[model samples]
Structures are given as structure tokens and as C-alpha cells.
Target: MIPKLPGLGPLAALLLAAALSAWLGIAGPISIEGLYRWQNLLAAFAALAAAAIAYTAAMAKVKLDRQISDEQLMRRSLAILLKVEFAIQVLRQEARELEEKLGDWKNKSFKTVDLAISEPKEILEAWETLDLFPGDLILALRTLRASLVLYRTDLAKFDSQVEWESTTLASIKANPTSRASVAAKLLIQQSTDTITALRATITRLTNLLNRA
Candidate 1:
């Protein structure tokens, strides 16, 4: 592979300079005449080579640092993407559960029942507290909110129908009339269907939120 340097840049330069100076002194003639001729020329050439080597070593270190920085950035980016993927998966699962619950509710009858008896406020609060309930989960939350409102409205309507049925049933009991009883039964059936549909809508919204 690549040759490794013990030190880089300024350190490498100082080392090379010291080594070259030592080599020249050991090899060159000590006489003043020889120092002014070939001895001086040889020392000059050795110094130039050492300087070139030092410059090359310093550039290699710079390149290595840049490579390390790039790798670190890539790793950080991958970690963030993984976290986002996990969040999406969690949202999807919760939405699916909500949908399933809605489907079950659709088959139920609640003509004389008060939806408030279920006290879904606590459930709503729990849903709101989920990690993905706001911001990115806004669309999912809105769907669930609409379903909750519909359920509340249907519950109110069911209560009114129950009151009307109670009055009609009393009248029928006093007069023993079949017509009033039949009319009351029809109203009850319609109210039951409305309540069931409302519950189904809510369940569907919950499922969507879970899946989101």
C-alpha cells in the first residue's frame, strides 16, 4: 500500500533538515578549499531534496484529514435517515389499529345509548399525547378529530331519539295503540344505524392515525 511517514509537515521538515545536515557534515571534507567546491554543491542538493520531500509529506496529511471529515459526515447522515424511517413505521402501525376498531363499532346499535357514557375524552387525550400526533402527524390527527366530533354529534342525536321514544312508548301504553309503537320502533332503528355509522367513522380515523 502507501508508505507511512512517522511525522508530517513542520515536524517532518525539521527532521529531514537535521538528518541532511548531519549527513553532509559526515560526508563532506573539513578543509576550507573542499567546502567551497564539490562539498558545498553536494550539501545544497541534499537540502533541496529534503525540502521537496517535506512539502509532499505535508500535502498527503491534508488529504488524509479531508477524507476523515467526509466519512464522519456520511455516517451522521445515515443515522438521521434511520431515525426518520422508524418514526414512519410507528405511525403506520397505530393508524392500522384505529381502522380495525372503527370497523367493529360500525356493526353496533345504540339508539337508546348515550355515547358520552363511553367517555372517550380520555382516549382522545391519550391519542393526542402520542409522539407523532402533531406537526408531521397533523393530517392523521385531523382525520381522528373529525371522527370524534361525529361520534359526539351522533350520541347527542341518540339521546334525543331515546327521549322521544320514551314519550311515545308511554302514550302507547296508555292508549294501547299499535301505530305509535311501530313509529317509535322505526325511529329507534334509524337512530341505531346513525350511531353505528358514527362509531365506524371514528374507528376508521383512529386506524389512519395509527398507520400514519
Candidate 2:
């Protein structure tokens, strides 16, 4: 329902006064000078009442508009946070898959390299967009991003050190003393370390976000 304007009672009173003044001017035994003075006074008061009502209504509209804008911003922030939360879970799943692949790294078909060398942006980007209502989530986001970046650096180094020819996997199994086998072992360790670090970071972050 539309709210009644402020000072409705006073506006009604002014209208009643004007009507009474007009009646007095037409029917009552009042002097022209007195009636003119009274009408002028009522006119001035009416104008003031209108101004006051207009100002009040304007202020109310401004306040309502501000409230709506704030609500929109909060919804957007929350949506971003939820997306980041889901992305974090995806990271955990991806890390688990990497762990499984590392155990079977000797297989030619298994993948140990090709991991992205860049930091994950879901957390950091969402952190930038959020209002940080929980506030401590900020630290969690920063820590996670830093850990991922550091791990990616090592992963990238491991990926670069080896030449992934078809003989790479066969040599690791047949001639375990070759340079390719040693490089593959180092990559297995690196991949393991990265997954462990990421699991720890994700654990801490999950506790913060879900309060679990």
C-alpha cells in the first residue's frame, strides 16, 4: 500500500480553513479587509504545508531507493560467495583425482603434468567482489590463493624438467635408474606434496566458510 504523505492532517486542516474562510466571505457579516487578510494568511500557510509535504515525500523516496540498492548489492555479493564455495569443492575433487593419478604415474596413459601454472581465480576474484561479512573469509581466501600459486610453481617446474616422449613411462618401469625415471619420481613427490598442501588449505577454508 502506498503510504500516506506526511502532514496529511495539517493539509486537511488547511483545506478546511480555506473552505471556512470562503464561506465567511460570502455569507458572514465580515469586512472585505478582514476577509482578504484571512485569505492571504491561509494561502501562505497552505503553501508552507505543501512544501513541507513535498520535502517529506522526497526524503522518504530517497531512503526507499537506497534500501533497494543496498539489497541488490548484498544479493550479488552472496551469489558470488556461493559460486566460490562450489568452486572450492571442485578444487578438492580435482586434487583427489590428481592424487590418484600420482599413484599410477608409471602408466603411460596416466597424466602427471599439464597442470595450470596460474593461481586459481575463483577465490581471489570472489573475495574482491564480496562484502566480506564474515571478514575472516578474507584470510582464508588469501591463504588458499597463495598456497595454490606456490604449488603451481613447483608443478610447472616438474612439468618443464621432463620430456614426455612415449618412452618416458616405459623407462620408469623397465630401467628405473634412467634420468626419465628419476624425473618422474621427483614429479610424483611434487604432485603428492601439492595435493597435501591443497587439502590442508581447503580444510581450513571449508571450516571457515561452512563453520564445520
Candidate 3:
């Protein structure tokens, strides 16, 4: 069975008042002038009551709509945060893999040491679309984006160096005694350190998102 609605007692009272006013106008013993005045007064009161009820109903509707809108926004934020967290995990894994690859740089050239990482396009897009509520989470996201951009910039520079090294150091061959070999080793060490730092950043971001 449908639940009875609340706040309808006043409506019933208003209807009863209207019915009584009509009856009084027709059959009450008061003078004609007094009866007319009473009717007019009742009519005015009823109109004011109706206006009040309508205004109350409209306010209730607006409140309900705002509640529904807030819920939708919160759900959307959570969904996007989950996706971004997953992407951060992927980035963490890639950072580890790149670190491992760096260890074998003795056998591979900078060209072969390709970290094979790319921008987290989906995460970035979701971040742009969402407005996370928690202040800490928002700050964490900002830091994460900044870290990602810095990492990418570093990678780009590494790639540019690799290209130049490939052409300039081609004749050098990077033998054990060559200065080029030592420089390559240093680059490998630097790349490993960068990957470690990137992994740490991912971990921090993941923790922040998890808290959310």
C-alpha cells in the first residue's frame, strides 16, 4: 500500500473552511451584508493559504532536486577516482619494469633501453572532467599531474640525448675503455634513479586516491 502523505491535514482544513463558508452564505441567519463580508474574507484567506501551500511545495521540489544532483556528482567523482587510481597502478608497474630494464644497460644501448612508457591520457582527461570534493585528494591529484609532466619531460630529454648519442657515438662503439661507455653507464644509473622516483610518486598518489 502507498504510504499516506504528510502535511495534507492543512489542505483538508482549507477545503472544510470553503464548504462552511458556502453553507453560511446560503443558510446562516446573519445579515446579508455580514454574510457577504464573511464570504469575501474566507475567499481571501483561502487564496492566501493556497499560495502558501504552493510555495512550500515548490521549495520542497527544489530541495529534492538539489539533493539528487549532489548525489550524481559524488558518484561521478568516485568512478573517475577509481579509474585514475588504476591508471596510477599501471604507471607504478611501468616504472618498475623500466627500472629492471635499466639494470641490463650494460648489454643494451640507450636505444634498446627504451623505457616504453607513455602519458596517462585517460587519467588526465578524467581529472579534467572531475571536481573531487576532498581538499587533500585534490592536492594529491595536482601533485600527481605535476610529477607525471616532469617525468615525461625528463624522458623526452633522455630520448633526445639517445638520438644524438646514436649519431655522435656511432664511431665510438662504447667499448669498456672508451669515455662513451662510462657516460652511457652514468646515463643508465640516472634513468634507474628517475624510475625509482617516478614509482614513489605513483605510490603517494595511489595512497591519496585510496583514502578518498
* Residue 24 miss distance in model 2 (angstroms): 11
Task: Summarize candidate 2's per-residue lDDT along 26-108 as a digit string, tens digits.
Answer: 77877777768778767876777777777778887999998777666555555666566666666655655544444454644
Clashes of each: 12, 0, 0
- Output the TM-score of candidate 1: 0.34
Model 2 ranges off by over 4 Å: 1-32, 103-121, 130-134, 159-212
1 or 3: which has the higher TM-score? 3
Comparing 1 with 2 on lDDT, the higher-scoring candidate is 2
TM-score on alpha carbons, each prediction: 0.34, 0.55, 0.58
Best first by lDDT, ranked: 2, 3, 1
lDDT minimum window of 10 residues, candidate 3? 173-182
Q: What's the CA RMSD for each of the models? A: 16.0, 10.0, 9.5
lDDT of each: 0.44, 0.54, 0.54
> Can you write out model 1's per-residue Cα lDDT over 118-178, one digit (the tens) per residue?
2234335534444322333434444444544544454454333342222223443332122
